[model samples]
Target: MNKRGKVVRDTNAGTGLISIDGQQFPFELEGMWKSDVAPCVNMVVEVDFGADGRVASVQVVPESQLAREQAEAAMRATKDKGAALGKEMVARFGAGTLAGMAALVCGWFVFNTITVQIAAGYSSGLSFWKVLGVLNSPLGFMNALGGAGGGSGAYGLFAVLALCGPLLPFFVRNPLAHLANLLPLLFIAAVCAIGYFGLMDGLKQAQGAALAFGGRQAAAMAAEMASGMMKEALRAVSFGLGAYLSVLASLYFAGRGAIKYLSSRA
Candidate 1:
């Protein structure tokens, strides 16, 4: 007798069973077949039954053919879905690929401009106009790269570094289109570091002065001032991070939308 079904094994019960068209039959898996194929649950196989009605031999189906079929099916489904999405986007956005690209560029420019202004103003305590001016100047972004007190030579070095930054993305392939992408984050970090150190220095000075006065009340006052400074620094850091993330989110959506529109035209 011959039967074709899926193999199932109950490890806890130490028994093997074959299920065929909703019918299950107890079977003893042959040991010789185990050398060529390991018995696994849910694997389809052909079984040869002895005259006593017990399984005498089993031939497990090769999984490679099934795997290949499944992979091809998945690829077809993905292609179909992509085609449908492309058509829908074209119908909605029209076939203006150049317009979509232009929109993306404009959106990125606006976002970058806003991010620079916020980061520079927060870090340097400069007005929006001054930050904008600095960003527009060829040497401007270099000045904002690090903290103050650098000599002319140091400034020149930073300028070179800044100029070389954008070229980095061309050399590297994985993620991060340009080093400029990290400018906003670096600016925020620099600002926070400055603020934190300044606060710590002030607190230390205040504590030293209070200790000189020689009273528990003075110590209490020093502690209070330190706490207040920490809270203010935290608030500033939070606000800067929030603003940066918001700008990044806007840029991401604009870029993604533009790409989608352009792809629809293809």
Candidate 2:
């Protein structure tokens, strides 16, 4: 009769390992049992093999153990995927990608602020240094997030999305072009969501700022400014979304029109 226990050690080298139950045996020549064996620091396994002079097949069993092994396998698979994605991001973006993204965001913020300053009756005479100071305000958070460089988990997601972004063309020709045309709408939606959340945060911050300043007049003025800014941000985001959708719809229809025109010519 066969007996089973966890493998305490592989005392027999390649031939077979000794189970904790003191059963000495030779595993199958095909090594089917070896593939099923998982070596952890102290993983428990239920082994089954008949002892005989001839080589015998050993199976690690316990019907319930199947689920445990599968769960371990799943964990390994996820770990491997995350590692592969991290490696890919390092290859594509290099170590300096974070710094580059920070610079890009800072530059965008500065340009937009300068545009706003000119529109708000501020003399176009603010020195470059003054503009730089304004840019520094938003840079704090943006730099932190961009510097984090999308951790291993987020990099895994980015890698998957990036791979899919390129592959879309195989099923739909000119997918890159199509995606570029569509991205404005996506960007707008993202901005709208960001604006909505930003409004909530700003409102909370405004209440805090009001309490900090004290005096009903000061609080009312701060609240009014916050509300005005929120409304403007929301309006801009909504208008941007509508315009982006309009452009995307026109571009999509135009592409269809071109295809139809060419098919008729052919």
TM-score of each: 0.28, 0.27
Give the per-residue lDDT digits (tens) of candidate 2, residues 38-112. Answer: 433233444444454333444556557778978999999999999999788667645443333333333322222
Top-TM-score candidate index: 1
Candidate 1, residues 1-266: lDDT per residue as tens digits? 77778877732365588787798877654452432666778988877778987667777867786789789999999999999998885775445433432333333222232222235355433322223334345255446434321233433344334323333444565344443434333443443465457557868888888878967788788889788867765554322333444345434434554454455456
Q: Which candidate has the top score in lDDT?
A: 1
Clashing residue pairs, candidate 1?
none
For model 2, the superposed segments whose C-alpha errors exceed 4 Å read 1-137, 140-184, 212-218, 228-266
RMSD (Cα, Å) for all candidates, in order, is: 18.5, 16.7
Candidate 1 ranges beyond 4 A from true positions? 1-164, 171-184, 226-266
lDDT of the structure predicted as candidate 1 = 0.53
